[model samples]
Target: MEPTDDFYSAYDDPTGAPTSMTTMSCAIENAKHMHTLLASLLLGRKKDQLVRCDIDASGLYFTAHSKGKSLQIKTSMVSDLFETFQYFEAEATSFRICVNHILDGLGVFGTSAMASTAVTCSYSAQEGVFSMVLTDDGVLAECSIKTMVDDEHNDCSLGVFERSFEGAKVLGHMILASNALHDACSEFHELPTGAAVELVLHPTSFASSSDDAMCFRMQAHTPTSSCEMELHKDSTAIVQVQVEATIAASFQWTLLQAGLQVLPVASESFLRLNAQGFCSIQHMLLLGSHRAFVDVLLCPDAA
Candidate 1:
């Protein structure tokens, strides 16, 4: 009897008393029972330092405290628990039959009262590693003897798949995080109100390291003056502006980098108009590592 035929035949009439039908039904029931037991064990009973269990459509998520820091565990693919078990077994540990339910269920050939099967598995944490034993019987199954180090951040120690925060920094095939971008822009102040400015950014160099210093040449344009700026990795930035003062006029300008407007360079320097009717004042500003050079542009007027 083929496995498919046996399954259909068992479903059609479970009481047929055929040996193949009986075995097929037994295996299906065993798998179902195993799933039920795992669900119950994961969702039930309070254990040491285990505070919260949150089950979502994705999988099981839980938080526990170990050594004054919070640790999180996420278990996915639980609906196909047997397949998941097999997957883990293939990678790390093999299932051991401490007791066989099938042999014990036959009774005459068995010696164990519990009719349980257990497998030992090990996992790692930052400070240390731990082991666990998962047992299953025809009636019930539970993960027991789980020992882990009391560390605050256990997620850092899990394997790639078991990680609670996997691929969190991945954005559009890039490893850059939003916070990194935000931090880079935070050095600039807001754009001045109603000031028309044109920004030009030039990438001076690229390096192998993600954190390498990038050199940029920026040009900011205003109605009466244009400023050129140079930014480097050392957080040092400089701006040189040539202004054409018609009547000792005062206008506000802002420096923008990575979409962030930084503090405006306040200038009270007098502009001595040249024969071209424009005066140029050269200035330099230094910024820290959390900033990047994107472009030089004028901003809205400060009305």
Candidate 2:
């Protein structure tokens, strides 16, 4: 969408003031795209706390942390997610800002405005105030949110993918549609909040049984699904499970439930298991013209 006159116009400050200072800024042409994406990442988050923001020439990254779980959401704003993205900093800059404030400034819906909101985000390089400007139907509202130093970094790495999982025994590997995995998680809601979702990997079929006794089996090769497994003592070679592998692993049903949030954006997902009973779930999502990936690592319960 083309930028409107109000959207492109620049303002020195919210109040009628004149200033010569220019700030580091970027504009998300379609605020709805950002609003929906943020909502998905921030779902189930209770506290409206500070989230780390990293802005660079590559893209914008937001990291949310609570309890012991940390989620890192990344997307390219220059070309992929944002219609127009610009960062003035030569090196990457990090700051702390409240997620609730950004969401509130977006105002995706429930507003009386007739036009979609255009958002402009700026940070004062000197004063360090993060500001958001929203324009809708010729009306503009600007907010300056205080920023804080981000001295902490969350080490949220995948943890030695090739060494750990490669040498470990491959219990089960299944590829299913995003909706299929979502339905599997939804069915477990009736049993218990923390009940484990059991996955039985067979030679030719993959069966998912919830704590509520709801069980369903999927073939290894179906028109719409695919399942594969390895039963050898030590082998990473993936082959269709044609015999009973007797491999069973359980994962926290709540984690699967949380993963369902990606269904609306994901197309297909692959589920894998390791000898240590670690399960990795990967989702392929299409974000506008770009393809994005989301992976969840779930630790299995003791047998």
Candidate 3:
């Protein structure tokens, strides 16, 4: 049957934005030709069965419903289905002439461009399904269509190739390092003595079957060679560091000995050191008498 103006009216409604009218018309004409062919193929078997056809820009979808049974046709392949239908439409032919034209078109059985480009096509006679997958120039295209006798379901699937590199390991490492540096700077306080300090954390080591912890060792070195100290952590939960400094002979010894005394220190100054080699000099104290001090080193070790 020719595509009437009513068929085109289905897409004219403003509510549904169906833009490709030319493609839709071609699909409708193809479906009509398929309907006629199917009728002739089943002529001797049943005369009461009614085959209906519908088409759009995407492709053709046809359904034959009769005697509590249905069969569907889906045109997913980019083939002569469109061209043959256009030929018949231009000829202004009857259903019989259109059916003959369709058969003649099918006789050629020209291969698709995808097929010529190393694509493989397969058909399942029992399932009445066709599939094509092509790979060329590092690009892939695939299409699948299925039609069943006495079944209302018909579907098509198409896909194109693209490159994807998600969940890469390098990205994970960068994110982890950024978070660690941010937390160290924001949460740790600065020391009174002007010495460059940073965290030197060690990887977690397994001490026992049930217990595991990290170790840290902090070191602070100043311009003068007079003062140098090291701090250590004896256990995973506590921060214990030893202070040893060498001061100039001219400076009073009392200044170098002041920080050695047992004084109440705040929690912010007392950072938890868990792993070996984990260091932070943010808590070192400066004494009034300790001038010409070499460096103050704080180192923590897992006990």
Candidate 4:
């Protein structure tokens, strides 16, 4: 079962002594912008599903686990997004809270307003509550949602994916505008179950093929006004397909479709794959004053 933020206030200890606490507070001038970007991270059926959020001097990080935690998508809200940023912790501080609660709290300030809503978000470890104060047009609203304690046994780690990616043999790496890739993937989105979407990389062109017995393939060549394709084996540099060897990998069609979610907000994207067909898509989303990186790793379909 997934974790969720509670609606009730945290129960105090029987001793009545306030326990050790960790607090992080920040003020933002544009709540709507933050709310919009954050809403994109919610996916599960539970409207109040918990998401791991980290706040630090550098930025705010949010991560959502999907596919039984095998897949993770993370986004960042840099300090530039805040009008006043103040965080204190012995180490990186992380909390799990319901994303919907945060959205609802921020959404109180309707978009029709001429100016952005001023928001102050604070959380205390001892209280286990995420509090938000929103002021719009001189009206103030305060919201408090209880946070979830971490479950060590249920926590997921990215070490497996990281290690696999680090050791996989790079077959090809390509770069393209987010829209361009999304447009291409749309053609293969309807491939029947068990069918695989194949990507063939040429030195100067790229093609996405689907094995539907129709032999349908959508090809894009480099030097096009919007799309750029590179294929190489040297992972250290921008990879380009070798002239002597053309590389191809087949991934589940549905997995590639997930990349489309990033297109609406991202400016550009990068695609990389290994000989074993494992693939990763990285996109940089454009927030108002800051930017975020969203990466999705998809396992390949069996040959």
Candidate 5:
């Protein structure tokens, strides 16, 4: 069974105590935008899949980790992204919610009907329950979901993410059209599950002796098949490439496909790898005039 907490342990910050999910709720005026955002957060169709949502004054943050925690994806919808936001607590509060339920309760899963929908989301810490109300064209629907707490989850280290945040200073940084990644992976269909995708970042001079400082290439291979592709300055698929030093690493193809699938509605993507070979990709999402972002982090595959 998953870990569940009681209100008995939830303390107020006044006397210097840690806070849980209390007084955290909001009204999402743009339910359509939120539906798309949660669609990106959905890993698989499994009904039991969970995501950790952190609520603060800034906005609501959804963080999900893979089965083995080898991959992590974080998406943020700022306060302005929602129609109305409210959090009475002085400290941040978070709880695990079944993403599938919220997505299904949305009612406008894949249609314009979502445009007419308004979502009211709130948490009941005392009862350890999360609830949502969907009002679409006066037809109201309500959903109640249980919450979970895992004390060890919040302790994961974020040191590796720092390198990706450092911008051009990282070992390799590539700004590519997200569509290109999807297309590239499609071309590697023969590389079955568990196959590895090799990414190489090098100075263009090393290959073409051109003025372009950096070049990015990928190789998808398995025991029976192999394929190679390169994104050049001449291609519209690539926007920018900067590399202080050439680096090459292999990452599980399946692990990356998960992140790539999240950006079907996005255009640009930022990919970076640090000296330690950890990968972070920021997929820029344009949700209804407002710009939201999804960040995916991956651990390098053993060579």
Candidate 6:
């Protein structure tokens, strides 16, 4: 279905000010599209969850830290994803908002057969309100959500496509089809809580037959037993693989699985890791003619 076009106009700003000074001002008419795409970013229970939203001329970056878990996720909704996106400030601005509130106030129902729901979002520093105006056909609904300070401490490098954070030298990396990787992780669904999953990479032997030359594998330990799956370098599921040295690291099962939320919709899965056990799994999502990305980073505690 063709997405509706309901761009936010200047008059929609609750501050009554022009877009020049607004920290974040954007609109998208595909309410259902936004809802499904963003819902994949939720880490845990949505209520009271905080997500750092960074807005620049290009688009929005949403970074969320998993509570008590050393994992960081950064997802982007580029300008192409929006109908009308504007960054009025001279420099980029960042703010923390309740993801639950933003998702709940989207007003996505009753939009399938009728006019699509157009969502206009902006932050007014004057009243300290993140205003959202939902418009569909002749209907309009306004919502105001509180903004908070973004005080995150973790770091990641997938945004730059370099080594893992903290200067860890990349030890192994692989690019593969998202659906294939998603199927490989299916065992995680059965692992009990607090389980640690291991990413293993090595050939069955230094020089083996094509059928036995596996290079990518994932192993999981449940409460009672363990399960593992291996992928050959020439496997149809693998797009590319580069592993000179052995790579075997265990990480918190929960932290690793969080990134899988986007796998179903992603076109490709990029995995890179360093000796420090810091790993990055990037999900490449296709958006219309453009593309967006969701990067998940696992930190020390997850090791």
Indicate the residue-level lDDT of 162 in model 1. 23
What is candidate 6's lDDT per residue for 170-251, written digit by digit as tens? 7778888998888877876788768888887663344544654778878876769797888887787788777657867788
lDDT of 5 by residue, 167-278 (tens): 4346878888887777865777566878889888875435545643337888986778888987766667778777768888788877777777765678799998777677
Q: Which stretches of candidate 6 lie over 4 Å from their true place?
A: 1-21, 110-115, 152-166, 203-212, 300-303
Global lDDT of each model? 0.25, 0.54, 0.25, 0.61, 0.71, 0.70
Model 6 whole-model lDDT (C-alpha atoms): 0.70
TM-score for each model: 0.18, 0.64, 0.17, 0.71, 0.83, 0.82
Q: List RMSD in Å for every model shown.
A: 25.1, 9.9, 32.5, 8.7, 6.7, 6.1
Question: Residues 256-291, candidate 2, lDDT per residue (tens digit)?
Answer: 455557766677776677767666666666655666
Residue range 144-167, candidate 3, lDDT tens digits: 334223322322111100001111
Candidate 1 lDDT at 205 equals 31
Residue 278 CA displacement from its true place in model 1, Å: 50
| Per-residue lDDT over 1-303 for candidate 4, one digit per residue giving the tens place of the 0 to 100 score | 443443323223222222255377777887876775676566645676667787777878887665554355666777777776666676777777778888877776565651368777777877877777777776777777887776535556535665666676776566656665566455444455445556665443324322211111333222322222332333222322222235566655444555447676677777777766567778877666576677766666565
Name the candidate, 3 or 6, with the larger TM-score value: 6
What's the true lDDT of residue 75 in model 5?
Answer: 86
Predicted structure 1: lDDT: 0.25
